[model samples]
Target chain A: MITIALPKGALLSDSIELFKRLGLDFTAFLDSKNRQLQITDPTNTAKGLLVRATDVPVYVEYGQAQLGIVGYDLLLEKTPDVAHLADLNFGGCRMSVAVPKTSPYQTPTELPPNGKVASKFVNCAKTYFQQLDLPVEIIPLYGSVELGPITGMSEAIVDLVSTGRTLKENGLVEVDTLFQSTARLIAHPLSYRLNLDNLNDLGEQIKNSVSKS
Target chain B: MITIALPKGALLSDSIELFKRLGLDFTAFLDSKNRQLQITDPTNTAKGLLVRATDVPVYVEYGQAQLGIVGYDLLLEKTPDVAHLADLNFGGCRMSVAVPKTSPYQTPTELPPNGKVASKFVNCAKTYFQQLDLPVEIIPLYGSVELGPITGMSEAIVDLVSTGRTLKENGLVEVDTLFQSTARLIAHPLSYRLNLDNLNDLGEQIKNSVSKS
Candidate 1:
């Protein structure tokens, strides 16, 4: 049976709706109160595994699940080995560089040499700065990176900006954008090769729904 | 007045207790329904700012709060610049390397050259592997990294192991201990330098509580 890993939070509802259009009844497994990790569909053609959104790719890449739905922010940061089947078009946002409103660093290049930048996405921030040949000390933060500049710990941050409300409330402004992010359909390379017929059908149905939307 | 950043979840109760011993009344802010960001103490000697455990350091480091209480696991993973003032000896855990029980790799050195290691603490994993000169791809996962090796996505994972129950349930075995972790008292360098007198007193009281415990 084909197995799909679905992110357990915000994306779960939309993912379930998408699968329903594919004629897959995965609603029982998608129920928020269901603590059961793995649930089989009544039709027995497929199964669903609920997991953290950031973990969807890991599950797919390892072939634990034939397919997965995850955010682009995670994909950009982790760069998992799974094949990008299609963009699901939900959970959209932008990964951007933000700085305190009072800071003089308006552009990426204007950032000082060897200055500190705090972000939960340390590797992502490092790669961004490396492209500019700028030496930076990446201070890894799990959340609330806006406080980096406010508390004088770092000069800027590279994080997901959903509505600009978080930045605005924290007295920060976007300095540069790295990428536009949206949820995408991903599959294990081996799974795609092993279950080509079934996976292809599933992919087509997802694409059809996305196009319709 | 001095300000303190306390974790909003499990640690909140303990933090309130500690502050009460310090002659500060912060119990009312512990209500989970309280939407107020900052709550003032009755005597106004200090104010409490409730935030995520992962965000505690960000608040303290940015000088938004002079001191913070956070788990050592988060501190090791984040490696923020804030001073490690005192070890609170709570929220104890160990960051360790783990792999699927079926894998033959027994030690860190046994990992195949250029193998993949997954972790939410990407920086921590990178530094650990680099110190041993191991050439492995560090896959950054947000959570549930234990599932990586189980599903064959990665060879191993570096994550916090509290009771080892989670690992055992997933058919994973501990391979190596990385670091011992506990909750800690952290201070912004500038805050410590400027408010040495008051900060030191508060630090002393907290230290006394830790020693007694």
Candidate 2:
């Protein structure tokens, strides 16, 4: 049996739709009343686990799910040992360094030495700043990265920005973008290599689905 | 003016109720239709910021909030430099190490050396294991830690166990508990030390509220 891990928020519907096109039905997740995190498709050939976007890689890395649909940003932040199967290409977003609009410093480098930068993606933020040779403290905030700047907890924040609505509403402006993110189909390395449960075939169908879409 | 950081989920209502008893009201948060993250008490003497439970310390530590209500577990995990003031005596839970029912290990020490232990509270788990002189890899998971054992991702999971319903339903059992957690009233170090915003007076009122309740 093949199991797939699907992210719960912005990428869920598109992920379900893509899987539906591949002949696996797990749309029960879209129902507002449905609270089940794990569900098996009607055919029983596959099952899906709805989890946080950040957990997709963990599930796939441990072979709990032979495959997972996750954002590329998480792939960067976590760098879990999973096969980068293919890009399914929906749920586009970007990770960027943002600061309060009123701040005098414009770019990451302009921020003061040893200043604090907050993010949920700590590793991603750390790497970005390190590459720039900026020695700043990366405070890991699990929620509301905007609060980092709004509350003066940090000089700036590195966060996922989509539509720029949340950032603008919070009076934060993007100073530098690290990368663009899109939905990605990832597989467990051993499962893909061993062709366990015909994952290679399902993986190929998913790749085809992306191309067709 | 004083700002208080109140947690957003299960503890929110209780935190507000406690504050109400102390003569400060931020009850707008309890309204089902309310969408605001930040609200001011009608009396205009204090403001409240509704944020993730883990973020309360960040707000208070940065002095954005003179006070905060948060779980004791977070204090152990984040170890943010904040003054531990009072325990409000509500929002009770426990930090525990849980394992799958079928797992061979019956206790933390029984688990194989260097086994991967998954937790959102990686620090707590690591500390507990280290104190036991057990060297294990602590994998940080952001959601539904029960999946750690169910998926064979880790030997066991250290997570918050409330009623233990989630763990029981997932076929896991708690092998040990790190500590019981209750919502604690914490203050910014400088704010509490300097009695800024008459924090000492407000602090005594909060302490009285808890005792009176």
The prediction achieving the highest TM-score against the true structure is 2
Per-model C-alpha RMSD: 4.6, 2.2
C-alpha positional error of residue A95 in candidate 2 after TM-score superposition, expressed in Å: 1.2
Tens-digit lDDT track of model 2 for B51-128: 999889988988889999999999998899999999999999999999999999999999899699989998899889
- lDDT by residue for model 2 over A1-213, one digit each (tens)? 998999989999999999898789999999999978889999899999988888889889978899999999999988899999898889999999999999988888999987999999999999999999999998877788888887787999999988999999999999999999999999999999999989899999999889988
lDDT of 2 at A117: 95
Report clash pairs, candidate 1.
Answer: A151-B62, A151-B63
DockQ of structure 2: 0.67
In model 2 chain B, the worst 10-residue window by lDDT is B144-153
- Residue B132 local lDDT, model 2: 93
Model 1 segments beyond 4 Å from truth? A60-66, A72-83, A89-141, A144-182, A188-198, B101-115, B129-136
